[model samples]
Target: MTPIARTRARAVETLSLDATATRNALSSALVSGLADALTDCGKDPEVRAVVLTHTGTTFCAGADLRDPPAPEALVDLLRQIIELPKPVIARVTGHVRAGGLGLLAACDLAAASREATFAFTEVRIGVAPAVISLCVVPRTDPRALARYYLTGERLDPAEAVRLGLLTTTAEDVDEALSPILDGLRRSSPQALAETKRLLTAKVLETFDRDAADLTALSARLFSSAQAREGMTAFLERRDAAWVV
Candidate 1:
C-alpha cells in the first residue's frame, strides 16, 4: 500500500499517510509523493491551503527504518515542506513521534486531537534527530525542546500545546480542523500566500546564520554510540541505558 494519500476539498488539499500498518512510516515513496503533492498544490491556483493528516489512530510513527530514504533525500523532503508557499496545517491525532513530529512541525500551523501525544524519540532509537530537528527546532520553544530532545520524553496534548508544538487541541480531528478551515476560507488567497512567504523568509533569515552551530551539534549527537544504542533499544522495545 502507498504510504501517502492525497485528496482535495474546496481550496484545501488534504494529504493522508496511508501506511497504517507500520504506523505510516515515512518511506521514500511517501516523501516523494508528498513532495509531488506540494508541487502540484503550488501550481494549482485552486488550492489555497493544505491539510496534512494521517488515517487510523496514529498520526505518524516516523521513518520506516526497514526502508528508509537517504539522509539527504529526507532532508530535502523536509525542506520542500518548509518552503511550500501555501499555508499547511497538520491535523494530528494519536502519537506524533520522531520524524512524525518533524512533519507536523514543518506545517505552517498544527492542530491536534486531545488524545494526541508527541515526542522526539530519536535519541532512544540510536540516532540523532537530524532532519526532524530542523523542522522542530524552529517551531518549538527552546526550553521545551531542551527537555524533550535531551530526555527523549513524550508530551501529552496539553503539554504539547503549551510547548508551542500544537496550535490548538480539539475534542476530535474534525472538531479541531473546522475553525482552521473556516479561517482559511475567510482569508484572501493572495494575502495568505504573501503572508506565508514573508513568515518563511523571516524564519529562514534567523536560522541561516545559525546553520553552522546546528550542523556541529547534529554531527556530535549523531556520531555518538549513545544515539545508536538508544535508537536500537527503542525499536527493539527495550529500555535505553545511555548515560549523559
Candidate 2:
C-alpha cells in the first residue's frame, strides 16, 4: 500500500488520506483507495457510515497536480464517492482548497474545524474548476459562486457553513463529526440510501437539460489562447498578457 492509501476504523469505517505533508493531496493511489473503501462499505451491512478524514492537521490540499491521474480515472473516483449508497462525511480540519473543496461538497455531509478554510482556487492556477464545479454548483449559494470562482479567495469555516459548504464548525475535528455519526447510527440505512437517491436525482435534473451547452462552452474555453496564457502565467509566476 502506498503512503496515500491508509485506512483505520473508528466506530465506523474511517478512511484517512495519508499524504500528510502534502496536506493529503488527492494522488491517484489515494483516489483509488477511497473509491474502493466506499464500494466495500456499501456492500457491508455492518458498516453504517463512512467517515472520510485525513491523518495530519490538514484535511486535503486538493488534487496532486504534480502526479495527476488521467481524467477518466479522476472522474470515476469522484463519481464513486458521490454515488456511494451509504452516507459519507467529510471530516475537514485544515485547509480545503480547489478539488479538496469539491470532495467535501461531494460528501453527503461535511464537518469542519472552526479553523478550517476553503477556496475554489482553480482560477488562480488558470484552469477552470471543472470537475469540482459539478459538485459545488448545487451546494453553494448562487450569489457567492461568481466571486469565489473568479477570485479564488479563501473562505473561513463560518463563511463555508453560511455558503452551505460545511454542515457546521466543530471545536475540534472529533467533536464536529461525533453528532453526525451518532445521528446516522440511529437512522435507517435503507431510508438514508433512498433519500440520497432522491436528492441526487433532483440536483442533477437541472444539468441534464443543459449538458450539451455546458460541454460546448467548456471546449471553447479550453481551446482559447487566453486560457493557455493564464495557465502559463500562473505556472511561471508572471502576469498573463491577455489580448483583451
**TM-score of every candidate:** 0.88, 0.84
Which number leads on lDDT? 1
Top model number, TM-score: 1
**Candidate 1 structure lDDT:** 0.79
What tens digits encode model 1's per-residue C-alpha lDDT throughout 1-244? 5567888887899988888888887878778777777889888889888899999888988877677655666666666777777789999877888888878877888998888888887766666677666767777789878999887898998898888888988788687688779998889988988888777775565446554565566557655788667656767887778554
lDDT for each candidate structure: 0.79, 0.74
Which residue ranges in model 1 land beyond 4 Å of their true spot?
Answer: 206-228, 241-244
Q: Candidate 1 — which pairs collide?
A: 124-230, 124-231, 125-230, 125-231, 126-227, 126-228, 126-230, 126-231, 127-227
Give lDDT tens digits, candidate 2, residues 3-95. Answer: 444344543787778888677877777777777777888898887788887777778777675665544555556567667888888887788
Candidate 2 lDDT score relative to the true structure? 0.74
**Error of model 2, residue 99, in angstroms:** 0.6
Q: What TM-score quantifies how close candidate 1 is to the native fold?
A: 0.88
Off by over 4 Å in 2: 3-11, 206-244
